[model samples]
Target: MKSLLLSVSITASLLLSPLVSAKDITPIQKKQLTEISGLLRDNPELINPLHSNLKQYLDGQKSLETILKTNHDYLYNNPQQPYFGAENPKLTIINFTDYNCPYCKRLESGLVGVIKKYPEIRVVNVLLPFQQRMIPGLKTNTAWYALNVWENDHSKFAEVHRLMMAKPSRHDSSSIMKIAELTKTQKDLTPNQKKMALVEKNEQIFSQLGLRGTPSLIIGNEIIPGFIPQEDLEKMIAKQL
Candidate 1:
């Protein structure tokens, strides 16, 4: 009986581990476990298998928690990235996007609405520019140049960003030059190696975060991949909060 009780307790602890600290089990799960404990006391033979299953569940939960926390911290405090929103925000959403992605363009309105609705939401935009690879002969230089322009003159970054977002289909050098001229964004005649390095770093970060596409948002510990409606976005934020 004592051994059976130990197994039951171990199983209960694993099930409840993700949602609370080891020292603090919630009342509902505690109550439910207590009831299960009484029944499990008669079935001592089941303890070993149940213990193994419980260990697996706890291990998976720990892995996921570690990932979320690591990602959140990486996105939140990375001084090298560009983000615009709440100052000293309570909620940070890391946004991976490409200027040439239509889905990212589509998501812009809803993302803007989220920031307006929640004064504490910070949207960190990480330029993955994977779309550049699709264009024949382009070496993903647009985003690299954009980042360079942003560093040179932050006050003009928004105008440059808007132009790039507006002209996703245009891959012609002249068209890019036109947009750059309009925003006074083309400072370097050649590919600025440092900015391209930053882009590479961001791409590595995107891959490390297990993202395959654009318009992926990291809200709290959760990653909302692809285009999501404003209502769904709100619900996700509410859940995290």
Candidate 2:
């Protein structure tokens, strides 16, 4: 029974593959599909979970589409959001990131490459501190500090951003403050209420989009969740361009 179920699962995945269409179905795959159909007929319960999951996925996608469409200008053109790249960009990519997220850190280099390669592209950085619960220091966290720097001095924000992203591990309040000092943005170390409010707004947007993790990118109405290699990142950017 275990083997049968595994086979059915594998066959179902193959059926769902983009490369395998009805017209392109091979003989063996057709046989497996027939067997899967038989199994599903015998056990209707198996389809329930799959159906529920599919419905949930479709609902999330629809929600994301609506949010992106409604907040298009805010996501791409918000002056408050700290960004790196062309001052007047032909294209924009909204990056949702968390300082404590390793994947977000990994994505930084690829994102930098994209910015360099595409001179007309602007990458707006939205600091979404999803990992705040796990990390110490709520008010003076890295995300909040970065936002504070951006709000106070736009010129120094870039260096602060770079220093934070360059950290090998998760940043605590102390490390975040050190970055601010290094970048000469340590004068106003006190947590600003306005910055906190902006971070809260970003959290709301993140939840509305149904984003499960950090390192999500919004490019040309498409939300790509998680880290992608430089090559794939370039391809997606090219499509947007």
Best by lDDT: 2
On TM-score, the leading prediction is 2
Whole-model lDDT values for every prediction? 0.73, 0.78
Clash pairs detected, candidate 2? none
Cα TM-score of candidate 2? 0.74
**lDDT per residue as tens, model 2, 1-241:** 6565555665676465543458878798788778878888998767866555545555555676778778777778787788889999988889999878889889999989988999899999899877764236534766777777887877887777878888878777678667766788876466777877888888889888877889998887567888889999999889768
TM-score of 1: 0.70
- The per-residue C-alpha lDDT of model 2 at residue 178 equals 73
Tell me the number of clashing residue pairs for each predicted model.
0, 0
State residue 175's C-alpha deviation in candidate 2, in Å.
2.0
Per-residue alpha-carbon lDDT of model 1 for 39-83, expressed as tens digits? 767776667776776787677667766666765555678765677
Lowest lDDT 10-mer window, candidate 1?
133-142
Provide the TM-score for each candidate, comma-separated: 0.70, 0.74
